[model samples]
Target: METLIVLDLDETLLYAVQNKLERDEDFKMGSYFIYKRPYLDHFLTLLARDFKLAIWSSADDVYVKQLVERIKPAHITFEFVWGRSRTTKKRKSVTDDYYFVKRLSKIKQKGFKLERTLIIDDTAEKSMLNYGNAVQVAEFTGDPVDDELLQLSNYLQTLKDAENVRIIEKRFWRNG
Candidate 1:
């Protein structure tokens, strides 16, 4: 079976802001400007070849669906596209602020094994419940020259054949 790579939306794959950046926005949605991460298209294309992809964001369901439709390549198909409604809301102990969490157990309920599942996200607090299965990436806030996706794609390729992804030390993946 191919590895199931679950991606976060807001700051992981793309950055949506109410105010426009100095660089041109990729598209506009409602009152926000959407900026695709640098190399997003190439990254998705390359990963689609070796992994089964999915989108699970903390954003609104309708917005997530619409935004994904706009960004996704015509040739690519995701295993699933989920939104805030599907996540579990939790409170942060330190800040006492509520946030959405994407529980890996939810994916397990859908028949994908945790051993072969990975969630790429920028916020550690959201995936704290499943640290072993999370790959933390730097937050993208519409930086036009950012190359995180390029480096991330190279890093992910190394784990394409791992039997149990949960055991891998992904915290320092950028250095590896």
Candidate 2:
């Protein structure tokens, strides 16, 4: 079975910059979020070594793909992307990362039993409290250029080394 890693957008992977994109009007002009972090391509490329890279965003597949194009260029592509499913922003207290797992699982069809998949998101609830290889980052809402982006590369690199699903839990899902 292939190991998959489903990534999230918005404040998770990219940051809202340029001031205009944050306002409602900028979205009409196609100005979306920006990457406030570094090592994005480096980490994803490194991750590609061990697992298939797939993207899961609530923003629809077309938009997600377009957004990726801005960064992905020609070197990378998502094995499979699921963005059609309806998903709503959740209250901060909620804990449910598997919210979109069914949709993602449906697309892959055969990988459900693999247990080597991963979800890297910014919300605790978004990762369903750490179910099925989900790993949540502390939320980033204020701006596009946060300091967290600097460490993202190192974090994901470490994740690649933790190959086993059990290791992911023991390493990242430990009690806070």
CA lDDT of every candidate: 0.94, 0.57
The C-alpha stretches of model 1 lying farther than 4 A from their native spots are none
How well does candidate 1 score on lDDT at residue 75? 99
Candidate 1 lDDT at 72 equals 98
lDDT of 1 by residue, 1-176 (tens): 99999999999999999988998899999999999999999999999999999999999999999999999999999999999999999887989999998888988878999999999999998888888899999999998899999999999999999999999999999898
**Candidate whose lDDT is highest:** 1
TM-score of 2: 0.65
Q: List the residue pairs that clash in candidate 2.
A: 96-128, 97-127, 97-128
lDDT digits (tens) for residues 71-105 of candidate 2: 56366778766564634444434554334432334
TM-score winner among the candidates? Answer: 1
Clashing pairs in 1: none
| All models, RMSD in angstroms | 0.9, 5.5
